[model samples]
Target: MPNQSQIFNRVVSDQEVWDFNVFADGIYLITIQAKAKNWRQNFKRLFSDDDLAVQVDDYLFTELSGKKREFKGPGTWNGNELKNSSKSVIILLPLKAGAHKLRFWVDEAPMLENISVEEMNPDIKEKLVLSLSHDASAIDFIYKNIEIENLEVKYNDNTHSQKSIETKTDTDTIMITIKRPQDKKVESVIVQFKSTIEMNYKIGRIKLYQDIILSSSVNLRSQPDDESKILESLADGEQINILEEVVIGKFIAGKSYVWHKVGAHGKIGYVLSSFVEIQGQEREKIIELIKFWAQKLNIESSYVLALAGCESRYKVYATGGPASDDRLGRGIFQLTNQLKIDLNDDSKPFYSPISDLFNANQNVAAGVSYFKWLNTTKYKKSTESFKKSVVAYNAGTGNVPVVGKLNLKNYEQQTQNLVSCVLENSQKKKWGNIWWPILLFVIGFFLAAHGFVTKLNYASAQNDITIDAISNFEPDRSIRISSATSSVDGMVYFLANTSFDCGAQNCHSVLFQLDTKSGQIRKIMDDVFGAAVDLFPSPDGRYLALVALVHGGVCNSGVYYDIIDIQSLTNLAISGYHSGRYTAEYVGDNKWQNNNAFSFSLTQVNCTGTQRGTRKGEYVYNMDEAKLLMRMEQFGPENNG
Candidate 1:
């Protein structure tokens, strides 16, 4: 038997042989020793004559990874204890990539032990799996600001399969199963996690023969309406959940198109699904791209996704192919020539002017790259709010007005232009927090409910100060108002219930930011919460504009911090809240005064029991000073009496 000290850490001394074997596509790693060998008691830190240069199998490579990222260390990199250890380095090599015989390339003689081998393999193959995945780790997506503990996945026993999964807390789990046709063999199983819908799409199953209906418009010149002809009629406000697009046919010059079928619109036809992603795909792609680049750029993927959502609806193209004659953008992000371009191609106009943005992969890189610069450069000193910079992005650099289709007066446009100019006065004036002030996070992105949902269903830490921080206001329970704007940042803000035209309910709200440069409202968010409607931005954008149920009559509750510009829909800011409850919004912006403030006044009714009015329900008074938070009472005083 070899020396146990070597088993623990130190290598066998003098005349000893060590044996090892490696597996295919796996790596063998060894940790570095600290002071076990007792090398001559260090009289003067010098290399010992007996110390041999550390050598691993010729194929193996050394690496370091972690919170602090390291290069070389004890026998191998690990989450073990060491003073001020922020990172760990390891000697590693793939088992099948040649050279299994690794002889620790040690510079000094030392004992090695606890030969633990951990393979941090890349799941690049996972992306190729064409199956719906239930594994949270399989694809990154889910609820907002949540730390998922475990995700539970269920498998059908009838199918021959293997599965491994765990349940997570405070996290939403996506379950999936693949329905396959008997004729085709699965090339590979790629579980696509549509974080937007909280559904796992199994792409492994072969495509089945299915037929869909066309709008049957008699006037339209039959199938495949002039590709790129910009037929507003074909848009049809179709609720189709486009599966995917391919270049099926072509016509007209510079007008070739990729055809796409819809699940929501319930038909098949061609529209510009080019940058128009499948309903759930957008969010999933965002996660994958963000995670990939986050690893590369050392930033949070969520923040990147959030910024992309805010800037360009995550669309890369500046002009709209379908609706952009009006100038709306496309893709996971919405970028504009209005913004500066550090990375540009300028060769292919069809391709992104920002060269890196031309490719989907590169698009995320460019988005994050631009944001990284902004975060460090522009907003370097302003630690207060995200208003101005976002405004600047929306408004542009003194020369142009950036986003939004709503009619703008010359004054507002000039103000926006001015704001951009002022923001650009310096090089890094626009860089700051990449993502902040969430407006709302929908259940999933444009997610189509998979398992038959007629009805929809539906946070830690303290450290407080001012009394103004807390809401004396109460939310109304089960009341709803459509198109009523809230005074978040004091502009047009509303939470209205919308239909998918496919009978799906989607809640939507408008989020705004104040252009620090112009001091005008810069609504910088996409609205549409989910199922439950009546959610909107606050007059000031500090708190999400919404109404919640309280003691009785039902009132409006402004969910604070629910304002994120990335979400397709707004989520109540509270991490944990009942989903089925209905809420209402005040009629207009009368209840709000400015950003970070609400014009709410609270009054508690004195109730000693049997008094008719008081008995019926708890009433909030001073309608003039206090906006209705929620209806604490549903019925009349007689009911309570």
Candidate 2:
């Protein structure tokens, strides 16, 4: 190879040789101009497929670095006139400071116009393989270690006489952009570029092609700047065709120094280089981001992933779901405007504007935030709390009839599907090994059978207790059992509704006691009104508490309780007490403090007869003394249930 600069013009019959020397260690460009063997070959190649014509038919060969490399000569037809066609081929070779020999030959007798070699920077090379977008009206040939002032471009288009070509130079690369004519279509163009650092390089043909969006949601802006007017937000992995690179674009220091004009969503806009990348590369990134936020929010990554999969299939710009009305649900969890407002406020960390949900990081952060709140706060007391919370996250807490039963409805199908998907995904993640589930199942089968036997024994004991409790009364078949609970001691307390109204507001029930060891039962109280929803026994089993509703209107009506001294077999009615301006009180959320004192939340409603607002407080009641010891008002309103 000629290392510096050399030119040979002659007709080659067979083999040829040239001797040259290099003065510096660098890269060099070798340019060759030759013709096809005959006129018939040139005419046949001009009408055939470009790749088959250019790559399959090799007209010349060169021996460089002790190896022979084949090259195709130019196959363009000069005109309708049949004649041998001449073409140019360029190659880049690295050479050290030493003497070198260049050898070349032809497959058939062809005319060799000239062969020239010139010095180039070490980084400059030929990009033989190129791919462009389908809507691309321009192409960029990037060369390193070169300046815009030293590079020039010339292209020949069959359909157009003139085309716009621009040159740009950055810190690393010199870019030559060739713009095609818009009015008329050109299938391919012959591109040639001459640089001061090297001889002329020629590209056979340039064909147009498509790429995808890399970021979750890339903002297509009117201007290539951080604060420019947004044209459209492109979704993750969305297919787009690049049209051109903007000349007057602002370069972001750490992100991107280039901005491309892209066609997508039936519109054209400029996008930063950082936001676009190769296709099929964004999914892993999105999944990793979800895991990152899930860890930060202390939520199971599998559950978050399942939720994202169900809600938006992990699409960051996803919007619209069951919770969405006119405002539209957004992000992975499909958080709606109302839900966001309910769970967050205008504060740092907690503040997630709807617009920010389009970003993957912000979207996952807000979704996981709501997810945690749903599990730990809103539906915290529901059965299968996590599963129910997932349902509530989509369908709202009102759809859930009560906290005790899941009772998810078909109308909330999205919630049901999400819950099922989450449960399945969670099981898969937790039990990675199949044998673990099989072993657990085998263990659970025996435990369930044992539980069934225990339940049968308890039912038989309850039946005996029921017979003894009714033995004192006259024969009556209508005394139905309502609720029952066993204390730490051998006493089984149960409520038997005797009135026709049964568990209704004004209905009454008889409290019965059964001593399992003694095989005897006694009536504790005969006037237990309203259905006893639940029973709470003291830690030592000395006193028992009952939660029951009192008869009254919605505003005046509230939950009351009855405290019973099991040892004395006496019941004390703990009715709603008027504290301050509150008219009625509802008691719930009971927690036993010790053997004598227990605390419960009391929601005082109908204050000053307005029947509008309710205030709640945690009241400590001493069951042994049958008195209220202290009460502390809580901050937020508590549901009566």
Candidate 3:
């Protein structure tokens, strides 16, 4: 057996063996803290050739009573740092009263800082203590081994006595409440209890009730325990109402950590008190404003919420971010002065006051509007693309490599991780909070009592639409339909993936037309240029406009467009990139002036190979003459004012 000092507070190398003696049979928490053995000093290593940075693994192998077990440690590259990071792993295992051996080794060894084991359920008695707020009207003291008859209450002042106490007991524990006087100020109270075998005293503190603000963005869990389901993530400086005062939770370094039950985002959840600071009012209004703008922009409220959580933590006066020109990041979404000017151009549909960067509503609107612009023009309309756009929002569109798979830098990856973390809490549980499950179960019970009538209605609402005699329509394979639209005359136009046979490179999905009346589906065209993003059908049922991504190289011109004459099955494919490196008509907002003509806005972008000097203006497409005409020229960059 190894010395007790060697079992903890010392480095344990790979393949090294250490033995410890457990005096009691109980669940024990085994903790291991380590850092990367060899950290990379070069920043260029962040963008490695393999697209993934090197990572180290941490796994511990243990043998107790001839039974072996493997425990996975929390060891991975920190998204925010280019260098190696420190990580801790805690595992609770049931250990018998005997000697146990643990062998630590992995492919890439990390520098072990410390390793220790503590019994979670010890045989010793617990001294109960309650951390309450001064505003608390009453608090309960429940003891398992103590009898109510043998309990006494002592207060620092004349706040309460035996006559003012309430007692109740079941088979296990006796609960007693010491009600505070309405006018008197109480500093602290002590509850003395005598069990069948021993006597102990519980010290309770009554401090002033203060507002709390999150110091950093963290998950709001459904329960006080770490293993509980996350309700949602709250941002830094966000406000919450403490439903219950703090209680002693996790213990570390001879000090107890407190977990507070708080109410936020219309739900009650538990948050560690250490993650929150004392000062900030409940800001439900700001949340409602974010939801409103998100709905107006046809974006996910959760995504926008995550963005704000990452940017400014919903703080109206929050500042400090990457500087652009002379301006730094400001307000909810951290929009710089220059970015505000660019996003608030008159050509854009949405508008906010250029000077009101500090206003909460205006700030959120501008940020969300900018995101919408990026979604439509710069990035693909998928969640992955949205993630890219988020990184673009922070770093810049030019920094993000829009090719095969995303291989972002450490900082960019961290931004994506933060947004993903916040989004997980919002999306994982649709109904939100702990009560939703109980509410759903109750509703399910009632529906079951009422028979399958309600179930049949639900099934009917969820029924799939089937078409008869559809050409080249394979029902077997899993094909994702990217976009769908319908004309006024009930004609359905859709874009879906073909059967792995696109003639053009980078084209995956194809255009399809469904005749609802005749029950027929027609394959309109093949090769829709990568994933079909959006479909817009003309009101008179004559034409369908399409948008799709081009996924070859970085300079392969990101997104392309097409216009198809539904009656003639003729397509006008608009190549996103011209051979001369000049961009071809990047058209958007194609509104039909009549059945024969439509109007669209031309967004000019930079060219590379040849300098044709791209044009920006509102243009008209006349179907009768099959000619494109410029209606009005837009102001150049020189006249941005």
Candidate 4:
């Protein structure tokens, strides 16, 4: 059945060659020549078949049809005649009008010296006969040129003699059914299109759709080329702002790749475009909440935002339960149970329930309240008040070191870094300028007054005989003369040892206002006792401001201060004290600016022995009204009282 179809052949070696295409449906003949002498031995080892003498396997794949097919069968082998040592097999290729791939291999290596395909005549009735002899190397030839038509092939391997075939044809569609051995689950059909057609579908350029980050961390380079220097390594999910795209002048599988110049973690670098995806909107809600609270709190929104980021990274339901001693600190601002209790105490006019802290708004409100209080009281509106408040917010008022002490440097640096990052990303303005001159003046005045009081205290100690000077005085007597101050009118109102003991049935100290002119010492009232005693006489000397440790008895150990009327020897007003194992001291020399009003420093410690948190602030007390006029501000280091 030879016709005018072209006959292709070549002397191939141990290499792959891509050639030929099928444009019609017909039976085709394929020929292979093995040049190796021990081909049969290698074939048996490759397929793990000891008895296999002349088996050959062929594979074909195509891109357009996305299919793959494999064929395996026996071929002729001759050991005597080297020139006639070859294999021949018939393949029925049912293909559409397109290019197709053909590959031949023996023992897992290229063995076909040449491969040729020629169509058989459709009118031929008798099947082509082949001699099954070990030395038969000549393959029967067939040729026919006809109009393209759909076709299907059916073949059976010796392992499973079952055969089936299917075919379908449409104006633009072609289908072929392949029946594999029973042990094989399914078979792959391979089809290929012309190289020109495949080239038309290749990707040449990409457009920037949105910002993105790599699926995993990757090194960011200073240039788009692979040889460029690496500037930094970006983490997965780190945001990227794309500036431009670059395409490499190399093609991979008929497609080119792209690179992008992006800004990541404050650095600009180039990264592969394929590795990244558009940045997500997951943290948007958290950012919005931070902004809302920051605006409401009247602080720099960026600072608040940065604080929140540093604290809990904008996690609204974040809890310090497992991390804290009391299992407190809930919500974004991490409001503690102690703070909630203080806020809800009936003694305080500004009271709110602790449960309200679970709500993000309320938690932020509480945190902002404390922040504002710290800024206004402890830092005193200094230029670095926000930063100081941030530090205090983290370490608590008790943990903050005194001003000018560089403790907490690491914590300060960490907070500064977070603040700087937030500021870089945000457009919020810095806090208003502070009145530096006024603050400096106040500090200078306090320092000068402190020096003068220290000198005066030294003079008084040298002249006065203390109880410690007593010859057989017991240290645990729990009763000692604390201090003595002379009134403006020549009256001596001094604190002295009383019979009352803190651990005994009745325990308290008594204040005596002595009139030297009359040589009469009048007992005023039972007063508090502390480690140290302080007495502030009003400018008129009619009232005395006394700060001392309240004796521990039925009441817990604490520090207390009260305004006492010298004539009546009764406490007009008491403030700056709390129950528990605590202590208090005068912050600076008590000042009597006027007869009716006097100011003093009260440093208070909450938990005594362990030294938890302490508060030190200046307070103005109104003697006539028997009340505290105002809390001037917080100052000095904790436990410095």
- Tens digit per residue, CA lDDT, model 3, 1-641: 12133324343443355567778655454544454433243235443211011111111121111011112212222222313434443343444567665555332334455556666434424322222223323333333323333334444464445423345422222334444455544344343323432311111111111111201356788877556799987875565655554544442111114466777788978766434432211134455556656766778777777677545445454455322224667666778887888767777654554656755556887888887766666676445677677777877777776665555434443354444444444454232211111011111111111111111111112233332122343444434343244443645565555322233353366666644344345567776665566676676777887766553333334455678988899999754223233344354565778777767675555444535355566767777777777787654443341
RMSD of each: 21.1, 28.7, 23.8, 33.3
Candidate 4 stretches with Cα past 4 Å from truth are 1-479, 498-507, 527-532, 550-557, 576-588, 606-612, 633-641
Instruction: Order the candidate numbers by TM-score, best to worst.
Output: 1, 3, 2, 4
Which one is best on TM-score? Answer: 1
Candidate 3 matches the true fold with a TM-score of 0.28
Model 4 reaches what TM-score against the true structure? Answer: 0.22
In the range 160-182, model 4's lDDT, one tens digit per residue, is 22222222221111212232333
lDDT of 2 by residue, 1-641 (tens): 33344434454543254566767766554544544444345444443211101111111121111111122222221212213444444444444555655444333335555655567545544322211212223333334332233323333334433333345321222333344445533233333333544421111111111011111355778877757899887775555655553333664421233466777677877776445532211344456556656665677777777676656545443455222243656655666667667545766344544444444545676777777766766766766778777777677767754357676545343455456556655655431211110011112111111110101111222343222233333343334344244444656665554332332344555666655454455678777666565688988888888877654544455566778888797787774444555556676698788988877887777544433467777777776577875477653343231
| Candidate 1 lDDT tens digits, 69-104 | 222332322222222121112232223332233344
Question: Higher-lDDT candidate among 1 and 3?
Answer: 3
Error of 1 at 497 (Å): 15
Candidate 3 lDDT at 33 equals 46
Error of 3 at 280 (Å): 33
- TM per prediction: 0.30, 0.27, 0.28, 0.22
Ranking by lDDT: 2, 3, 4, 1
lDDT of each: 0.31, 0.49, 0.48, 0.42
Candidate 2 has its poorest 10 consecutive residues by lDDT at 203-212
Task: Tell me how candidate 4 scores on lDDT.
Answer: 0.42
